[model samples]
Target: MLETDRLILRRFHKDDWQDLYEYLSDEAVVRYEPYGAFTEEECKQAAISRANQEFFWAICLKERGGEVDPIAQAAGKLIGNIYFQQQNPPDFMCWSLGYVLNPRYQGQGYATESCQAIMEHGFTKMHVRRIAAMCNPENTPSWRLLERLGLRREGHFIKHKFFKRDAKGNPLWTDTYLYAMLAEEWPVK
Candidate 1:
């Protein structure tokens, strides 16, 4: 598990299914995600896939600080998730950073804290040079979060991308705003 001042990051597990579905299936929690809500089967696959992977850790809270305490929360249960999809020779010249916090946990500055930790991890541990986040224009919260994390708005692709939809189904194309921060531009403590 990855620990922050008030949070922890770890992978998903079978026990997380009920809470996972509780938040993830809630449109408010995943409204901006690329895909619609997941089925039980999808959630199962997700847990298994994430558990088997080296990356993919759920964000939990230390709350009171203890060893072996699943003290962190998931998708805003306590904190939220911060993840990276790395590239050997990054095609886009960056790793994609994604996070989702339950609406009940919004505006608490958890995303900012979690993101800051992961950003440092990506640059220092992963030796990444650039990291970026993509969000729909309508997702003001996410956009604001990226900005709060110090990523500059780099691109605004209009209707070039789609989400929660398929191209074959009239493709409700959506505008995607790309925000990025380079290792050199990262703030120094």
Candidate 2:
């Protein structure tokens, strides 16, 4: 488990399926993300698949804490979710970070909190030398978030293919960006 001052970043679980579905099905949340809204079954399958992954986290506020702990914990409300997609070759010490927060919870700083926790986990615990995220240029929020995380803009590619609007629809091309941070380039703690 990964802990931050106000949150705990841990693996996704079966219990998270319902909440995951709620958030994952939101168009705003998945707008910049590769996948669009998910169906209920899709959410369940994803939760099951994620439960077995080593680097994914179900972001939440500390269930137990000092007086500062919020009266409620951070599960069902799902301000957002974050995952680290491993590089194709397991030998490579790198990952791609991805996240989506509920639109209601946007601008509350939850995204940054979860990301900082994950970054610490990736570099210090997961031994990742390079951590990266891809953003859609049109998605200003994600674009700016990557910069806030100290990840440098590696490149901006035009006409990148993302998921289709629906299962049987033709794919659409959008401008995408790749941002990355290296162990040596991390900001001083």
Candidate 3:
């Protein structure tokens, strides 16, 4: 588990389904994602599935100054999720990062904090050599976040991803920006 001053990044719990649904079910939150808004059942299953993953984490708000322990308090309110998948050939020491935040919590630096922690964990704890992330070109905030985190934009793939179906049910193809950072480039804390 990772803790920031006001947030805790921990493994997901089965009970976190409702919290996950709060954002996953919102179309706006999933707009740039390949998947559409999720049903409650899908959220529940996703929570269950994610709970067993080694790299997926639930981002929760830390409830300050309570009788309960900080971790317990922090676990109570889920605000987002993050994950990293190891690239092919585990020995390559490379991983792809992904994250989502509840729209209500955007513009607060939480995404940057959480992602920085993950990148550090990957580089130091996981002994990863490189970390990469990708976002739709239209997702300005996302690519900007990646840049702010020190991942250099490596490529822009035009019409590379069929993200979802449009209102008329036609495939919606979008461009993507790929970003990456080598461990040598990451400042060790």
- Per-candidate TM-scores read 0.83, 0.84, 0.91
- What's the candidate order when arranged by decreasing lDDT? 3, 2, 1
Ranking by TM-score: 3, 2, 1
lDDT for each candidate structure: 0.73, 0.77, 0.87
Top candidate (TM-score): 3
RMSD list, candidates in order: 3.9, 3.3, 2.4
Clashing pairs in 2: none
Which residue pairs in candidate 1 collide? 8-60, 10-57, 10-58, 11-57, 11-58, 34-164, 60-72, 60-73, 61-72, 61-73
lDDT of 2 by residue, 44-109 (tens): 999899889876778765643334445544443444578787897878888999887767667868
Worst 10 residues of 1 by lDDT: 70-79
Which one is best on lDDT?
A: 3
Clashes of each: 10, 0, 0
Query: By lDDT, is 1 or 2 better?
Result: 2
Q: What is candidate 2's TM-score against the reference?
A: 0.84
True lDDT of residue 182, candidate 2: 94
What tens digits encode model 1's per-residue C-alpha lDDT throughout 1-189? Answer: 556776777777765665556567777677778777877777777767767776565766565333445432443343455667875576545788999875656687878888888888888787788998899989898899999899999999998776655556766788999998999987743
Better of 1 and 3 by TM-score: 3
